[model samples]
Target: MTLIYQAGQAQQTGQIVPQLFVSIQQPSQVALNGVSTQRIGIVGTASWGPVNTPVGLSDIAGYRSSFGEKQDGDADMGVAVSVAQLQGANDFRCVRVTDGTDVAATGTLSGVTFTAVYTGTTGNALTVSLSQIGTSSNWQLTTSHAVLGSRAYSGANWSSLQAEVSADGSAFIAVTLPAVAPALATGTVTLSGGTNGGAQTSVQFVGSDDSDARTGMYALRNQGCAIGFIHGLTDTTLAGVIGTFGMSEGIYMIASGPSGDTISNAIALSASVGYKSYGLKMMFGDWLYYDDDTLDTVLISPQSFVAGRLATLAPSESSLNKQIAGIDGSQKAGLVSTGSSKTYSSAELTELFTAGIDVVCNPVPGGSYWAVRGGYNTSLNTQTWGDEYTRLTNYIAESLAGGMGAYIGEPINGTLFGDVRASILGLLSDMRGAGYLDNTGTTVPYTVVCDTSNNPQSRTAIGYLQADVQVEYMGINRFFNINLQGGAGVSVTVSNG
Candidate 1:
């Protein structure tokens, strides 16, 4: 009799019987897909939701439903998301931060305790009521909130009433019934004692990165976020810290200085930080006057606006000359603070830029519209200063990191090198096709080398396989100059094709 063994199963050794062994192998060609470069990550305070847990938000309604509305401060996560949404950023991974003093609002009615779903002052707005249905044995339970709206449940008995509310209840509150059922009664109980905790410091915002329990900013790791910002954070001391995090995690971080800060102060702060990296983009605090739903017109930091604008652009595009949406005016231009409209002079802007600071102001190089003056990061190196360098480099690096693991266990041979090189070339070609890479003319925009030259016998013996890649990113037109000559006696020359 003939016997067959499944793939990956061992066959008996030295057996006289005939046996057939089958083996299955993964496809040699690996297709690399580009990671999403548009998703923005935000770490900030909120009135609701689990603390330090990353939540995906696509719209303002989802943000409100998950994280509650904007709190009464500048660090609200919802406010950041709202402003970012104005710049056409629809994808977000938001992490809510809170001090340990936060408390969930709760109330008791008919021997049932209702608690807010998450810890925040937004729970204080909830009210629950129980009433008899038309004087019958049946009863009705209703939960209401000003922002979350209202929901009602009807049931013939206590058990049924609890089930109905549990099945289709308000997302804002959770109902807990007592051990013993109580008779239905008509009364309203309002939740109170809810607190939003204290303001967060930079340490809390950075959070811990323990593999078992990540919190705050570290909670956003591996969330596929290409850009991130900590709302209202202007601490110069922490710039390098956050910049290092961004560099290690392949995320671009947008940071800012204090709103209404002076030019000298901004320059001094940048110099004091002194840490330069392409992973971070620091903005000059030309505070913007933004209309908030809860706080009315407030002067807010410029990080969220910058992050949103970057999120709306392609990986290779720059923020310079790109008009930012939903900005009522800036402190300098709108006269909100000084009672007089003041714009940055060329010399003042030059000083700020020289100090590695960028600002959003009126009269961009193109026109009088408000736009980013310089599309640059904190890096002093000219080669890596532009926003494109950080974004496109991270985009390509992350794409490879996500796809190159397939060759880890494969045999180290010529076929492995060819596959690896081909995979990288494929992604680079796609990038070129998508206008992310370009050269002067009639030349390939990238180069890939993976073979015996770079990977010798000594390296392959130790299971080391390396593929070196070089890509030329498309350049942004930062400056445009024109020569003009006009005189009555001067001759004009015209050229025709």
Candidate 2:
């Protein structure tokens, strides 16, 4: 029998036709019984056969000659399956073939669970219902749209807009949403065109807080609101338009030029409270009873003066010295006090006041009084001289009457030890000589108290007595000379007078 190959095809069988796949087998002399070897368009054919007809079969089993040719010798006889026929059978297809194995559904969103997906040549759109369960159930929508405005950039385009959401909708704050994909250079990118239109609308009932961490609005909704930045009012052409600026409050506006817009009363009110910054100006007010910078035009009652009672004089040499040395006859008293009422700055009047303070007596009528004629500092950290300089300068410059005086001794106790002692003696002597102390040149006992309690350097006790000389000078009858005479005396009388 000649083995052949057959390619199977679906036939209109009353019963379900089982697909047959056949190949040539070895039986050279006789064909398998009850098997119809159908030729499959080629010389090689296939047919149904009994299960055990061709037993002990091999590639070459029977030897015979075909088509009236008797075989005297073998002529390379063997069984072979037609590779082309086998291939055609492999490519066979069944009617109404189910294609559920290899093909996949197109356009699957990787991490999204879409309740419904609409795909078309136009575009693909996914409808995701917020789920209380799966990842598709709960979600945060990220979009690029400006819900709030910014001064830096304008227009409806939200290239810089951001949004966010939370569990609570009422407190739905603004958030920064990622920017949408830019339009392709080709232009006209299609979105899902459906009843939904593929455009996201009220996906969120309300927006959350702003995600712009630098924005003033973000600061307010957050906690401490401040914009430590500068922005331009116009297009960002030149970076020079903006500069480094700061504001404490969340909301602030900068304006320039004298426009019709006046400053809000809130600004002035806040300024009075604390240091606040505006565009170019700053407002400040204090407890000194000032509401605004401008002077109040309203008529108001004058402030009443508060009087100060003088401290009681203690019985001490320094106190006595201070009493006598500080004493100056009134402008109208004694003689027509020949003195310069004209005051001068410490630098200008330093010589006169210094000389008077040193000599302990300046008989120049009204100029003889001791006063703080201010001085200037020659070096750093020595404000004493500067203070004196400023004081004397200001007093002489501003005084209505009397010429300014200088301190008799240095401001510090230890610094002017001898000067202080000598100044006391000289001042008392000058007073006595001028008859301001007494009517004659008799050596009058000027009770001088030496209290060391307030002294910086103490020797014996916190409170103790130290003897100091008290001298008296006289205006001589001859030559009208100012004479300085000294005499030795001891502290003997203690009268508490």
Superposed on all Cα atoms, the candidates' RMSDs to the truth, in angstroms, are: 3.7, 51.8
- Give the whole-model CA lDDT for all candidates, comma-separated: 0.86, 0.21
For model 1, residues 1-497, the per-residue Cα lDDT tens digits are 44455544654466676665555554678999999998999999988788899999897899887777776566777888888998999999999888788999999987888888788888898898888889688888888877677888888867887788667634566778788888777899999888888878888998999999898889989999999988888887898988999999999999888878889998877887785889999998887878886778877888888999999998999999999877778978883345545678989988988888899987788786778999988898888999999999999999999999988898988888889999999999888888788834699988999999998999899988888898887778887779888889999878996
- Output the lDDT of residue 127, model 1: 91
Q: State the weakest 10-residue window (summed lDDT) of model 1.
A: 1-10
Estimate the lDDT of model 1: 0.86
* Residue 52 alpha-carbon offset, candidate 1, angstroms: 0.7
Cα shift from native, residue 84, model 1 (Å): 1.2
